[model samples]
Target: MTPPAPSDENLLPAPVLVVEDDPLMRQRLALVLDGLGYAREAITFSQSLGEARAYASNNPLAMALVDLGLPDGNGIELIEELRAQDPSLLILVISAWSTEESILGALRAGATGYVLKERDDLEVSLSIRSVLRGGAPIDPFIARRILALLPVAADHIEPEEPPRPVEAGVLSARESEILELVSQGLTNREIAEQLVISRYTAECHIKRIYRKLAVSSRTRAVNEARQRGLLP
Candidate 1:
């Protein structure tokens, strides 16, 4: 007889580490991992970088969800150490710090994904899932902020002329409406509610807007739209 195949939950990577200082945030992350089919016993939670490092030294981790502001030190240092220990390890930074330095530093240290703590649980869940799927999920706000710093960083270079306005027909009417709501900082869920559509529908419209504007993040889409005079 053929042996029974393992379920998806049983096949999930084990010995996951979550390095976070806040008690509430730790609990929230624990719940998120649990909902994602990770066994409670397979998950380890540490509140400081020191504890996390000690644990990492002893155990081979498959994945880590790290926070930037640890009680003992910055999470960036830990990320560097973890990456050095296991190049294949999946590390996702779930941090409150959003400065350009923080964002760039974490990425340079080999974090596979960077998600802001301010994001709701749904957003965080999606990011974790993306990591599991071998995708790097960056926060749109972080992406936008990083893009804003590029021109300033290249101050010595001559500035190029302003972007030419795209044709008014570039975006469909519904896409324009969705982009406007996005500029207002609405989440996909909020946009769906406002437009009386499914969250998936709202997300699809936003993706179309991204394609039309040639921007990958929501902030960049809005900035591009403004530059092209698609939105006032």
Candidate 2:
């Protein structure tokens, strides 16, 4: 018997892997991927950690949507393993668990985006797109929840006042400009476009900013800047 050829959409992009335990949710997610213009063959669905691990070992996935609660083991373990294997993988957590612990743990485990299954499919697709573009896509509600859990006193403590005008030499004018845009939540691509620079140049600036500030992650970089009175 002859099998039908893969669709045009499948040929347009790299594969996206879905590691979910629920059969229905798996199908729903596949549908979401389809809505994002990915063909069936471009989406690989796994119902357990073992299957996902095997597939990941053999395939180079462009992105992965993982569920935390798996039949074999917690999905965090799989996320950590995958991250250990490939640090550049864009892993998003799509689970019903939205507790602070689950969200924070997923980020710590190298998942770039933590999306709850309750969110509509459109939001999920948007989050996938955001992660693909190197933008961190944290759900607004989840962001609030995480913020509420932070120590309130930290916000009340005012650090020593920095010098007025924050010496231009503190960070190169271009680096400071890039940091400001970063604090505004702009992705490298958006920053590049706004600054009329290439994405690679913007990314290079961000890396230098991270190294100079001795911080990683945009959130931390922003916080460091505020502490130093570089931003208002």
Candidate 3:
């Protein structure tokens, strides 16, 4: 949708816990979430996932924005615990680290979406919105990498008879690969390096993937691909 106007239409006001140590960036995130009608006033800032977990019983956690590196422990664990407790809870991971291992681990931990702190708020906001609306938010290049890592499951993966290409409007095998990596939280540069290509080329491929999938961000692409068994 066009993003809930300036007004709020969300079922729950959505108390989003923002876990970040950086003061400036934290404030910027709070502002962006507010502008997007998520709830800036209800936001709580935590330097570590430990602190966020401490308030679990008291605070109503409708959603959260987590940072990977924290003072106490990796924030991905927090997302995992919270998600397991409440499967409907929304989670978004914001981290500067984009290694294949870290990205994959976070997704496996049940993060509904992932974003790099270095990315613009447009990227962050789009990601959060997509996840909250029942889609996975991921970086495009990362999507491809995850796909490459997908286990070969014949029952899940579509069989190829003469699989030249699905179509211009359809998700190709390569795009499915990229979207899987994105779900795992890989960055464009990392995805390119892993695929042995230039960053620009990787981005162009991601754009095409997005168009074919009709998704605006990484998380949505990943979710769609998974639902279609394209990630496998």
Candidate 4:
């Protein structure tokens, strides 16, 4: 006898909306979402933030895959707008770049997660599912950067106070530029525009900066950067 086939009726597909500007990227993203078993309705694609908003207004989106730079506006701004409309919605930042400032900015703006489009294959899909399930799926390298940024002072097991304020060291010119925009709380897409670089390039730089400074969180990095006279 043949094995029984699965029924679509038994399936619960999550509604997804993907917003990206590049045509090839947009279509490719839809394919990824489809592979995850989401409905075509669940995976609407738009090249601009404006179109995303329009779609969201008409249909309830369970999740969103947003790029940093859209033809009309920054996708981060849409995250804010969508969150305002539906607090329960899951907003994930998907872009080529992952600037230190952009990551922190989106988190502050109420995004539920972040993913790099450069590697949005199986790893990215699993990550999205993980975030939706209450896991904070940080990239391994990102995790290390975050861990470095964590305060050295352990829990109130009363550790000895530092004898001197150790300087975290000044950021190089390129790193400083990245940090300044972070201080302004700009998203990676916005930062990329300000600095004129590809989104992928921006993210790579952030990862490097994190490793160099031995800091994890953007807040810690920015604070330390300021103290070291790295930021103006």
Candidate 5:
């Protein structure tokens, strides 16, 4: 049975890319994309890191569902490469492997969402929509592991040396506010909407914040801010 087309105008105009080595998995993912209202011709599939990289070179992707295990190379390499190409590209890790290292690595590499292949098709579709709406769609198990990795002050544990105090004035008030929102896990699009600023303006502020904090990832920026007492 054919599914109806997507009505959301905000959905990406470019086709969704799927990088998975397994043929069956690729077909399954295509069905899921169909459920999301992506026409068959609107989907691109690659079986390995090399093939995926090649496709990404010529195409402008709106989002990619990547499998970590690839025949030619690691999928994280492709994630990094695509991220370098388009900072706004939404990358989602879809893999059977759930190692904490793999999950966190993908996120740090610029993936906006992570979902275990064992999840239901509906869940995966929901995750796609969630990320498209400017939310991180992490699996529950992965979410718990991530939460555990975050540092929390514990009275029973001995305190380490405090972080070097960062001059709060280094960032302008607006930039500081943007950083705070970034720390709260808001995407650039969401931040722009929340602050009534342009998306380009929000992105510019985020880049400036990253440079000032000397950090690459959102987690690192937030941690540095907390360590330097920039955030409470």
Candidate 6:
């Protein structure tokens, strides 16, 4: 069964590790975590991969926000190491790097979500919160980039008959509406505001959508919906 969605109350006691070389970016992430109800003492900041590794060795972490470019080494290495350490750890890549290699590498290395550093504070906060809530939140630009590669990837596959299109009525009208908002990169809170529903209700709809789609992450759900003709 799918786990319950995480809330601010549950996240309050979970420790978070932030690995970023830029002082400004580190401070910004710290502020975001604070705003999300993470205590200052519960959040740990490391300026280099070595420091992050050091902290990880001695402490248990619930989540980690990492950057791709670091002073000591690529952050992907740290991500791999952390994932090896704790399979349940929620890792989100928050970096200026948007290259296809960097993006795909992070995901393959077990990042739960990936967002560009160029996104504004609100977008970053939403992505972080989504990760905490067991949602995989990819930046819109990143999502588009991944989608653009789908056809290219399919080119290498052996020819076969086309698959049947997904039935439109497989999802309820309300579920379809929620999926549309999700495809537009809206968070549950934003979706709730847009549809005049409570955030909890919005989350329930999203979980139902995920179940129907047989996908665990928002990015996968949107991609599956589009492949099945559920979205434009």
Per-prediction TM-score: 0.62, 0.60, 0.60, 0.56, 0.62, 0.63
Scored against the true structure, residue 207 in model 5 reaches a CA lDDT of 60
In Å, residue 127's CA in model 5 sits off its true spot by 0.7
Give lDDT tens digits, candidate 5, residues 1-232.
3334478733644457899999998988888777777667667889988888887774446788999999888888888888776676778899998886798678767788999999887788788778777888999989898777666524334543432343333776787888899988999889989998556456656765676788888898889888888888
State each model's CA lDDT, in order: 0.81, 0.76, 0.72, 0.66, 0.77, 0.81
Off by over 4 Å in 2: 1-13, 152-232
lDDT of 3 by residue, 67-184 (tens): 8888888887887788765555678888887887788788777788887888787777788778777889887767776777677433464543331232444655666666777877
lDDT of 2: 0.76
Worst 10 residues of 1 by lDDT: 1-10
Candidate 2 local lDDT, residue 54: 98
- Compute the lDDT of residue 115 as modeled in candidate 5: 93
2 against 4, candidate with superior lDDT: 2
lDDT of 6 at 97: 95
Candidate 4, number of clashes = 9
- Model 4 lDDT per residue over 1-232, tens place: 1112224522422456788888988777666666655546445678787788887775545677778877786777898788775565677777776766577567656677777777746777776667666766766655565466556523422543332322235345676678778878987678878887644345545644565577887888787777666766
lDDT of 4: 0.66
Cα displacement (angstroms), candidate 1, residue 137, comes to 0.3
Q: Tell me which residue pairs clash in candidate 2.
A: none
Error of 2 at 167 (Å): 39
